[model samples]
Target chain A: MIIDQNKIDETIKIIKANGGHGIQKCVQCGACSAICPGVKAGFPLLCRALIKDLLNGLLEENIENSSSWGCQACNRCTEVCPQGVRPQEVVFAFRRYQANELAFSTSAVTSQMNLYETGHAVFTDPKEARRKVGLPEETPTSAFNEAAQQEIRTLMDNSPMGELGLF
Target chain B: MEQIGLYLGCNIPLKNPDIEQSFRKIFPALDVQPVDLEGAGCCPAWGTAPSFDLNTWCAISSRNITIAEEKNVDIMTGCNSCFGVLSEAKHFLETPATRTAVNNSLAKINREYKGTSDIYHVAHVLHKKIGLTKIRENLKYKLDGLKIAVQTGCHTLWPSDVYKVKEDNPYFPTMLKELCEVTGATVCHYSRLEGCCGMGGMRSTDAEKSLKLFKEKLLSIKEETNADMIVTTCSSCFMQFDMSQPILKGRGVIDFEPIPTFYYTQLLALAMGFDPQQVACISQIDRNPIIAEIQSDTRRIKEGM
Candidate 1:
């Protein structure tokens, strides 16, 4: 990819706008990528690649990439990066950009919708499972309590996430 | 008794309540009380609130953290993702502007992010706050013959800057290994000891590829250690190690018999002589035989003496 200073500056602006404050600090040392599970698992545009792409002005263009969703949010990249780029934050920022455009990897949809409805990204009907182990059918969580679920839904609707009209 | 507001995230109390049961059983045995952080919701998790932006993520996580903050007890979660999301939320939410922003959102629900409470993963609580010497003293059963391959999990180690407790070195973690040793189970070393189990978002994205990644890690655990079972500190790792074994074998991903897996709390609960069914009944791999082996061996030793 040819260096487009225009594109680079634009990418940096958009990412910083979405909270990738350290996007420009990336030196492309590949240290973050070296230990990234998504990178090792064959997600092409994760740590180093995502940072490299964003720095090369590939923000909107890479919006559809599932690699951002592939991140475990383990923050291993942040720990290893010498530049303090916090590659995980950059990945999350790109995810935010994608989330804003509503161009999410299909796998992410259920969890987002679940979070909206249930307050938990990963939820299951707990009654049967909990009872089998002699636990209360209702876990003291938002999933069971109607008021708490409403509280969570209202909170999500009241934030920038609600601005996306995901609900 | 020291009290921790038990923040029950999605996986532990819902999908695998057995781990929650085990944790509850073990904490009291150590003279610590598990306080329920009732009406606690999600950490809002990464794929959900966090995928949008940090402000929204922190706002949502602050709901949970501030619940404990009000109670004046620190938060402890069995799920590493909860620990990761909540800790990172607490750390970043300390900024005045961010704190003010999220506090405004929180004011709707009458909860405030006071930044008074801290977050602890099960591993951190086990190794750092509650020492291993306490662990060894409380054990009624010894895992004399069992060998364990320990999965310390990624979130428990990295971004150590945000964590209240940390491994001396994240790369070569000894805390989980030492926690196992207190049960008298020999902790084995594997090449992929610190690698991801591919259980979290990666698995949610691509199941086959995620299993493939775990297969590589499982192979390392199987061959490098040839251990009796897999032990881990995170519930996600427990789900991956325990539930994936039979599926992997069925899919021809691995050629060996299934290795049972446990969260260290369950192992400690059993070592303290809790009923296996109450503490660890739910599993893909049968845990009954392992339970019998540990219990029977203990009973026989006591009888002999």
Candidate 2:
């Protein structure tokens, strides 16, 4: 596969801007892949391969690969990287790039909607549960407070995720 | 007594209020006051805002932290993912450029990110503020002779630099083990102690793959230790083990008897003599066996005294 230098430069720039400063420092020692849960779970590509692809601008071809979405972000990759590559940050950077430039998965979309609608990603009615536990029907969360929920809506509306139509 | 804002995140209050109750019950006993950070939204969740944009992540998380800052207290959470996103957001906002960008978004809601407060996982507060000796002295029912498998969860230990309180050895954390041991439970160590519970984004992304990862850890715990109960400091991990295990068992993915899971705070609340029905009752897996063990031990201790 031919490497696109422009794509590599663009990806690298975004990564560096997003606190992935150590991404360029990655030595491709495979330490991250060795401990990656995604790799261990039979994902063909992982932190090491992803970093190599990101640097080589080879990620465009493999953009739809489930491995990127499967990352648990466990940070074992970051913890073991000898060069301070912080591969997890790189994974998140790539994911952000994927969501904005490529396409995000359905689950990500649902989560964003959940956050936008209810101020929570996994909200359920807690009145019964709280009553069962002998606590007040409503705790100090956005579940019952309309004003706080409005604040979350405003924050989401003003942010990049909002611009992307994610929320 | 130092007071801290209790950031419940989303999952615990909605999906697992028992975990919330446990924190409420345990905090007062330890001389730590858990003030409610009212009108707090989600930590915005890592898989959601964080995966989309850094500034959005920071803005939403900073809004939650700002609630604690308003009350002049540090924020603490029982959810590891909450700690992960909030602490990492705080770390990003520490940089002047990121802080400026995030605060600009917060300004839309008439809020600002001061970056004044610290974020803590519940275990960190217990280990750092309550102290192991104090925890031991206050136990109403010691967990003597009970074997427990400890799941530290990935978020609590990872990116250790951003975290205010961390495991002494990030890879091989002893704080959760020490806290469990203080209640007289024998902390069982399994090979996959640091493994992910497949709880967060992974489960949302791919359920089968997530369960496979969880099954590997479960089999490891059963193979390596005779742990009577699984104790974790993270609410998501508690749901993964306590809630998901049965579904996996029903699907024939796992063959062993399901091990009940407890948040460490729930165990602490139980050991402090709170009724199991109130603080520990909402689990999918029955806690009767462990509760029986605890009750028998308490009876023996009282009779001997």
Top DockQ hit:
1
Summarize candidate 1's per-residue lDDT along B195-233 as a digit string, tens digits. Answer: 999998888888877887898899999989999878888
Error of 2 at B5 (Å): 0.6
CAPRI grade, predicted model 1: medium
Q: Candidate 1 on A1-167: residue-level lDDT in tens?
A: 67889988988998888778898888899999999988898999998888878888877787778888788998889999999988888888898889888888666677878888887888889899888888889998888778888878878888877887667
Per-residue lDDT for A11-114 in model 2, tens only? Answer: 78877775567888988899999988888877776799988988887656766876777887778888888999989889888788778774767767777888
Global CA lDDT computed for model 2:
0.85
The TM-score leader among the candidates is 1
**Clash number for model 2?**
0
Every model's TM-score: 0.97, 0.96
Q: Residue B106 CA error for candidate 1 (Å)?
A: 0.8
lDDT of 2 at B32: 94
**How well does candidate 2 score on lDDT at residue B271?**
86
